[model samples]
Target: MKKVIAIYPGSFDPPTNGHLDLIERGSKIFDELIVAILRNPDKNPLFSLGERRAMLEALTADFKNVRVDVFDGLTVDYAARVKAGAVLRGIRALSDYEYELQMAMMNRKLQPDLETVFMMPAEQYSYLSSRLVREVAKLGGSIQDLVPEMVERRLREKLDPAIKLQDARKMKPGKRA
Candidate 1:
């Protein structure tokens, strides 16, 4: 089998179970699966860069061919640097496909050689997303089913009742950006 290195890039805000599934599957197709945790400067992530990387490393600790790292810049730029065979993307639904398709095309334009391979995960995690997981957890709801045990605990730590209450106290009402 010809060895190929694939880069799976994402913010991995907390690296949900869905993300784990993608990495696990990506490992089988590519000789090396690099889980590049993106440091998106635009959004205020609930977790810090180091915290996000730690979560990802913990989640994919068992896969022999799966490695975790962080990248700050355009994903296509990083993919080119690592000579990635193709950018690995997970498609959950039609909406997701539409967005990912746009991104893949743009990446292709940026670098003609770089391609994107879309992987559809198993049905169990087809609807799972970090956004919904965070919303549920932040509202004091159980997230045991949405993520791994360690990730559940970590999510709770960041969205603990005490911490949430403290944040609410710090919020300024009727403030416009």
Candidate 2:
């Protein structure tokens, strides 16, 4: 029997509890789970690619089959390079299906044999997202539920003390972008 390798590609920015849940669940079905960190030059995340990878590695340290890696360019290319049998996606809501479906379709076109599998996260964490986590953390709100303690600390270090205050000053009323 051929071993099944699944690729879960994302910016991760800062992996959260919801992400961990999906990863842990996916690892059970595939012989190897690749947690790929894709480069997004457009995103000025608080965490660097290396920092994000380290955090994820620490979070998933217990899963022997799970490995952390980084890649640039198209996901299909990465999937093909790794010989992934399936691409793992976590669906949080009905709205996400449209985009995910479109991506899956495109990936199928790129590689007909490659498959995409969607996993619905647990109800309690379905609504949790990286944007929400950052917004809460930016405003001095608690992120205990959305992220791991390490992620929370990283967020504080990167955004708190002085940087967050500087950003707040630039946020004038009616300035929404």
Candidate 3:
């Protein structure tokens, strides 16, 4: 029997609960699920590649069929290199669907044999996103429910220093305000 391998590629910059939800589900469907983190230089990510990789590795440690990896360049290219049979993606809403659909079509064009599988995360995380989680954490909002505990801790450790610096800059130098 042929082993079914699927690649779930994303930035995963401080992976949120929504991402984990998909990974958990994808793991069950494929013989092996590779959570590939894209090393995108175009966008300024909150977490470093190593940090993101560590977080994902830790989060998915218990999943026997799941593994985490970092990749550069095109997802389809990486998928092909890894010999993945399919690419797993999460669709949160219409906006996401439109974007994903275009990418999936292009991926199909790029790799004729590789298939794209779209799955929706649980209803509770339909609106959850890594960007939103970062935004909320940046503004001193709680993200306990949006991410795993380890991720939440890492977010605080990563963001709190900058937040504290900002707070310090706002305070009067010699006055106890």
Candidate 4:
């Protein structure tokens, strides 16, 4: 019997809880689940590709069936190259469905053998997204619940340098400024 392989490709700027939820679920369904980071130079990502890959690796380390990887070019092409039977995507809302449906149709046309599987995150994470997490972190808002602690730390460190300064200032009440 052939092993089932699936590719979950995304920019994963900061891999939010929604992404992790999908990864966790996908890992169980496929014999091997590759969580691929799209290497798009045009995107001004808050987390570098390496950083994102590292966090995913750390986060999914417990899942023996899941692996973290990076890929460039079209997702369908990448899926074909990796011999993935399907492409996994998470749809959080109607807007996401419209866009993803179009992309899935196109991918189906491009690679007749490959399939697109859309899954919805748990209700608690339905509204979470990497872009939203980055925006919240950029504005120095708490992202403790949005992403993993490691990712949260990195996001704050990369997006808001002043957070550290403010924290230090708070630690020394007398040196307020």
Candidate 5:
């Protein structure tokens, strides 16, 4: 039997629990799930593509059917190139559905064979988003349940370098950023 493959594309600056929820559920629905990272250079991302890929890899290491990859240009084209049966998306709210629905229709127009599957994250994660996670971390707020432990650590390292240095100095007598 031919494998049923689906592509899940996203920026994933820091993979949050909500994203993981979708990935976990999507993985079960498809024979092979490709977690493709969008190389969008237009927007400044906190984590590099490589970093995001690594985080995803680590988080999904246990899922043998799920793989992490990167791509540029149209997502539908990428899906076609990979021979994906569907483009999987996670919709958290109506606002997201409005934008994603338009994109899904556009993609369907481009590749009639490729279908778009929309999945919702768990209820606890309904209101979670990477943007909000970044904002909370930037403001030095707790993000314990928002993202994975590794991502939380990385976020603190990236957004609070000065704070870390100040903390270290207080602990010792010299450390600086």
Candidate 6:
């Protein structure tokens, strides 16, 4: 029997509980699940590629069938290179469904043999997203429930320095307030 390998590609700046939920579910569905992180140079990311990979690796360590990897360029191309038979995606809302549908169609056009599988995270994490997690962390809001403990710590470490720098700039040179 041929092993079914699935690639789940995303920027994953800071992988959230929603992402973990998908990974857990996908791991059970596929023989192997590769959590591929896209290295996009155009957009500035909250966490470095290494940091993101590290967090995903740690978060998914318990899933023997799941692995974390980094990739650049087109996701379909990477999926082809890895011999992945399907691409796994998560849809949390109507907006996501629309976009994912378009991408899935385009990917089919590019690689007719590859399939796209869409899954929804648990209802509790239906509204969760990495962007929202980053926004909350950046504004000094609590994110304990949105992400794992390790990710929360890393987010704080990555954002605290910037927050301190911004606060330092706001203070007058000689004034101690």
Model 5, span 1-177: residue lDDT tens: 888899999999889999999999999989999999999979899999989999999999999999999999999889989999999999999989889999999998988989999999999999999999988777656778889999988888898865465455556745332
For model 6, the stretches where C-alpha displacement exceeds 4 angstroms are: 161-177
Instruction: Assess every candidate by TM-score.
Output: 0.88, 0.89, 0.90, 0.90, 0.90, 0.89
lDDT for position 150 in model 3: 94
Candidate 5: minimum summed lDDT over ten consecutive residues — where? 168-177
Q: Give one digit per residue, the lDDT tens place, for model 6 in 1-177.
A: 999999999988899999999999999999999999999999799889999999999999999999999999988899989999999999998989889999999999999999999999999999998899888778766777889999988977889875565466557687443
Q: Look at candidate 1 and tell me the lDDT of residue 98.
A: 84
TM-score, prediction 1: 0.88
Task: List CA RMSD, all candidates.
Answer: 7.1, 5.8, 4.8, 3.2, 4.5, 5.5
Worst lDDT run of 10 residues, candidate 2, spans 161-170
The digit string of per-residue lDDT tens for model 3 on 1-177 reads 999999999999889999999999999999999999998889899999999999999999999999999999989899988999999999999989888999999999988899999999999999999999888778766677889999988887889875565456558587442
Tens digit of per-residue lDDT, candidate 2, span 1-177:
999999999988889999999999999999999999989888887689999999999999999999999999989999999999899999999988999999999999998999999998889899999888888777766678789999988998987755465456557677542
Candidate 2 error regions (>4 Å): 162-177
Over all chains combined, what TM-score does candidate 2 have?
0.89
Off by over 4 Å in 4: 165-177
Model 4 over residues 26-106: C-alpha lDDT tens digits? 988899999999999899877788888999999999999999999999998899889999999999989898899999999
Worst 10 residues of 4 by lDDT: 161-170
